[model samples]
Target: MNSEIIITKDFIEIGKLIKKIGLITTGGAIKVFLKNNIVKINNVTPQGRSTKVYPDDIIWINDDVYVVKREK
Candidate 1:
């Protein structure tokens, strides 16, 4: 099953989402993680850490899948 990440705002940065999900602890780590791992947003590789992710977007990091959902 895919994991869900709840967002309160209209969008969240790819780097922030990585950090929020506990994949990395520091902002700089996002760079390293992105470099070593492939992350796909909506089945497309993100431009970078600043890539905007909105609600209902599907994020894939390696074999793990994450679905973005708006907070109710």
Candidate 2:
């Protein structure tokens, strides 16, 4: 099953997302995680950590996938 997160914003950064998903604990950990893994948004790998994730976007990290859903 895919992991899911609810948001009320237009977008969220990949680093922030890493923490939200509980995949990485500290802010510094994101750097190492990103260096070793790729963040795929909508099935496409993003260029860098600043990649914006919107509602209904599919994000892939490590061996899992997360679905971002907007909350009204």
Candidate 3:
């Protein structure tokens, strides 16, 4: 499913975004999930959890595509 996330700030980390978006229950789960899954940001797979997700960026996790929107 396709989803849109409205961010009130500049950017959010990939891991943090995952948790914030309710994709995962906790930050601890991100490590395990990332190890077995892929998080494609702007059509590119991130190499680490530190990848910065900014507004207007498209992120793909599993079968879901989440579009990030900025408020400012």
Candidate 4:
């Protein structure tokens, strides 16, 4: 599945984005999920949950794709 997230801020953390989009239920699960799953931002694997995702960034989690866009 593909999704798009509109953000008003300059950037959003990878962990928060994952949860915000309903990928995971709890905040604590982010670490485990990132460890077990393949997640990339703009075609590069993020360093960790603290990775900043800015607008126009593309996130890939397994086969799903998520695009980040700025709020207009």
- Predictions in order: lDDT: 0.95, 0.82, 0.88, 0.94
Query: What ranges in model 3 sit over 4 Å off?
Result: none
Q: What TM-scores do the predictions have? A: 0.96, 0.84, 0.88, 0.94
Worst 10 residues of 2 by lDDT: 43-52
Worst 10 residues of 3 by lDDT: 30-39
Tens-digit per-residue lDDT, 1-72, candidate 4: 888899989999999999998989988899999999999999999998989999999999999999999999
- Candidate 3 residue pairs in clash (backbone atoms < 3 Å): none
lDDT tens digits, residue span 1-72, model 3? 998988888998899999988878988788887888878999998877778999999999988999999875
Q: Which ten contiguous residues of candidate 4 have the minimum total lDDT? A: 19-28
Model 2 residue 71 lDDT? 82
> What is the C-alpha lDDT profile of model 1 across 1-72, one tens digit per residue?
489999999999999999999999998899889989989999999888999999999999999999999998
Q: What local lDDT score does residue 47 receive in model 1, on the 0 to 100 scale?
A: 88
Pick by TM-score: 2 or 3, better one: 3
Candidate 2 lDDT, 1-72, residue by residue in tens:
488888878889888888888888887787778878866788887777677889888888767888998888
- Candidate with the larger lDDT of 2 and 4: 4
